[model samples]
Target chain A: MKHNFGAGPGILPQEVLKQAAAGVLDFNGIGLSILEISHRSPEFEGVLNEAVKLVKEELGVPEGYSVLFLQGGASTQFAMVPYNLLPEGGKAAYVESGVWANKALKEAKYFGDVEVIATAKDKNFTYIPKDFTVPADAAYLHLTSNNTIYGTQLQEFPASPIPVVCDMSSDIFSRKVNVADFGLIYAGAQKNMGPAGTTLVIVKDELLGKADRKIPSMFNYQAQIDGGSMYNTPPVFAIYVSMLTLRWLKAKGGVEAIQKENEEKARVLYEEIDRNPLFKGVCVPEDRSHMNVCFLVENPEHEKPFLKFAEERGIEGIKGHRSAGGFRASIYNALPITSVYVLVEAMQEFAEKNK
Target chain B: MKHNFGAGPGILPQEVLKQAAAGVLDFNGIGLSILEISHRSPEFEGVLNEAVKLVKEELGVPEGYSVLFLQGGASTQFAMVPYNLLPEGGKAAYVESGVWANKALKEAKYFGDVEVIATAKDKNFTYIPKDFTVPADAAYLHLTSNNTIYGTQLQEFPASPIPVVCDMSSDIFSRKVNVADFGLIYAGAQKNMGPAGTTLVIVKDELLGKADRKIPSMFNYQAQIDGGSMYNTPPVFAIYVSMLTLRWLKAKGGVEAIQKENEEKARVLYEEIDRNPLFKGVCVPEDRSHMNVCFLVENPEHEKPFLKFAEERGIEGIKGHRSAGGFRASIYNALPITSVYVLVEAMQEFAEKNK
Candidate 1:
């Protein structure tokens, strides 16, 4: 009955974990472990196919887009996005909202010129930077939808003149997005999806082949699309587990249904953080991420005590990132609202004890 | 009762599978699934550390080398190798032993000049080319230690004036090799190591940083070494299973013991292939792989019937690659000699029935 709140490589549905465990022993009664089967095998091909289909169905992805399951997490995408989309000597616009965004822009610099059109770095990224112009001359505008460390999110995507490449690593599928709005959306599966091996890349088919750089087969979005994400041996088991998780999401009535649950979970948790005198929210109210609710204790001494208290109550991974030193309760799609209730109860109990 | 002989994402030890399943359910009694735990958690860090240590110990990797568990399989490494090693306008030599080697060379061309010094393509890669001079002027020489599709392996590593980078994907832990001989050795963890998703890179420290190109952090060996293969969220579960498999290998008396067993397995299977009137070995006798035993039906009509007969006895994944038509029984490290005996018995019985 432990509540998992770790950010990225975060919580997954219990049933998905059980099915994944069972598959590791005997996948679909084939007497073969999922970990031992060939990716070319019909069984694994089916898993990869279903996983891609679920991503499309869950996100309502338009037909003109390609959904890819690739390796190397979102960090790899920081380089890949520019490598594929940004042409030689072309510039890409970036909004540096957090550490990840800063890293993304830095990687983009290796390929071509980068313009930091907007950033919330001044306030330590406590709010998403909204007032910025999308440089039309730029090849693309790169954005981080949710800053996991800073607990801020782009509440609404800005209408851009050029292609928008968003790193939705932390908050994908927690809410619905118009697939047609962005040229590309990449998310590491560790958060709100499944595990840590595979990355989900949804790219507009037309946005590719414009970079004019000689891209390696693995890094080329078109190459991956042409191979149907099997250009080489894919991260098989991770894709399989992700398929299981997506199946669980579909069974729970898809992304729209889960989005409501996520909103409610964040609502209650944030409400508790606000009402309790000992705790305070970390980010601006409007920009606060529903996926990760970052907060701080008013009395710094209460931080250690509250963490231990939460742990005793089966609350785990609530500790904030070292960069943002307080607490962060990540309410991913798989994290049940009941777990949020438990956290709320613990917070209240701790507040009462301190008083 | 089933014998898995898939080329890769191949068989893992049953005990390793069981433990992996248990860990997926509740990793180390931590009340969290291994898939759900943070990569930075002490638990997973311990797992990653032990995996690196085990790779070093099992391979007798000298202190000057680094062991990296990366993602995107060997295909990714094809580009990464050249990206990190081949400097701007520098020449690298490659041996085109098989399809994989051809692909590796193709990737190298993207970075700099790639010279194919030796090739077995004339014989459909039926043998390993032995006589080739290592060009002293080249930055490094690339070689494929074993060709999975062609069933040919380099029985002896060639002495080189420059550095040697080898793709040992299919035969890494099946036998021991001197780490000092190579500048870089990378293998996708599917054949002899673990499942698909992770790649093992063992590189001599002195070979890095000479490539005077703006190498992205993920592809740069120096950055990866600095981060200790945690440059990004590595293929966590894949690395975990690999560690478990390596641990299993160590307990089974490490690579030296496995080599003898692998040799015996290959000996008996190849002996059966030679003895059977209906079957014939695919590659040259001197160069046949101990890991992937490829053979052809003397009568083309016998191929399907022989496959069915083998399948009836619960023999799996023995079908040859489409390019090389016949059968391929991959006797990887985790595959027991008993499984080889089962495959050999099936071949004998099939031949008797045909006779």
Candidate 2:
């Protein structure tokens, strides 16, 4: 019983792993291995179709929206959002909060004029800015829904005058969302869904083809939507595994149930960190991410010892990202509640031992 | 014992499949599965480093070349090549021969001035045009090393005035080549190497940073190279499978031995097609691809019967692409000599029954 609290390359359910492992050898009793199957083959086409269908069904995607499975993860989508929607010489509004948000803004600058509406960079990205104005003239208001490195999430997606484009990379599929609220939303599959390979881009149909630039076919959301994400050979195995994970999500009662479990897990960890004498929570309580719980150990010496304790206890991937030090426990959708309790136990045990 | 002749998501060695499936469960005895492990983890980094090292070693890559594993298939690279290599307002030369070649040329037009030095469109893409003269002032001379759909291969790369950029997507790693001859070479790993998510790019380091436009980080080869393909979460599973396949290729004595075996397989099948009274070879003998072997049946009615015959004999994915009719059997690196014999026998039986 290992407790893995990894960041994206999402921690998957063990059963999903077993099924994925089985698929590598023979998928659904097909004589050929999934790893060797051609993307154009009927078998893989079925996998692609089912994955698209499940994501739409689970998300309650509206009639006009198209759910596409694309490549290059959230980073690609960062640039692709502007490339597909921002007309030449147009301007888009952006709210920067974390590394990914800044990266998105930087990429957008290449396509068109970008208006920086607001940024939490001044405060080192510890909190989500609630009062940012989106200019009506801007093509779109781009923001990161969840900041993984900063351990923050935009709890309430404030109404924007322009169309909303959200990079929900680390927190998508963990909660229910209003599909109509955003013009486009992209999530790297690794965090809430599957492994690293495909990015799920849900875009409103009417918003496409407005951009004047010659968008690369791979980054052109319209082309991908028209091609059913099979414009080229898709990341077949990754999509298959994503389909399985989505199936698991549906079977466990969809996003609502998963969201409830997620809240409880976060509450337990955050509450423990608040009550425990040896640690301090990093993010502001209101904006703290349920997915990534960042905290610092009191006394720099305890940091090393506690990490060692967790390591010996078989708790993996708790190490914080390089930019944001201390520790980060990314309790994503597939992470079990039991893992949280185990991590809390490690924290308590370490404090007792050192005290 | 399925005779898989699929045109991509490269056919894996039996041992490679078993090992890959096992890695999905427990990678190197690390309690975490490969799919769940973070891309930044030491284990995954090892996989990435080894994959790069093996590819470079096998290709005998020159000292200054940078090998990168990236997401988005060859189609993404179609535009990314010009977006990175061709400076703003500069012209690049291209040889258009097959379906992929036409697509590449079309995409390159968006990035800069594309001069089609020669095209085989007049012949319905049946042959490679060797009479084209590349302009001395062109940024690069881009060409497809092998045409998968038309079954045509460039038997010898002609001297180019400008730097050569080769799209070796369909035939990379199948044969040895002088890496110094090309300024850049990119292959979608699905064909001769890994699965369908990642692309392998080998570029001359000196040629990077010359593009006048600001490239999106995901599409920017220099950024990806500097970051070791971890500029973002790479397709972890794809790279791992690629590494396993690369290891298998190395164990099989690398490219030289595989090339000999590939030659024998192609020769046996080509000879059978040529000798058979009921069939005709499509590609010119001198420019025939060892990877993709296409042919035509004497009687158009036999197409269906032949397809059914191949299916019954457990030969999957032998059906021809829609654009190119009749039949196509892609004997990639992993396709065994025995599979070719089996296919030849099936062809012989079909002709005998039809005749």
* Candidate whose lDDT is highest: 1
Task: Tell me the tens digit of each residue's lDDT in model 1 across A19-53.
Answer: 99999999999999999999999999899989999
DockQ of 1: 0.90
By DockQ, who's the top model here? 1
User: Top model by TM-score, which number?
Assistant: 1
Candidate 2 global CA lDDT score: 0.90
Instruction: Give candidate 1 misplaced runs (Cα > 4 Å).
Output: none
DockQ of each: 0.90, 0.84
Q: What is the TM-score of each candidate against the true structure?
A: 0.99, 0.99
**Model 2 docking grade:** high
- Per-residue error (Å), model 2, residue A229: 0.6
Note each model's CA RMSD in angstroms. 0.7, 1.1
RMSD of 2: 1.1
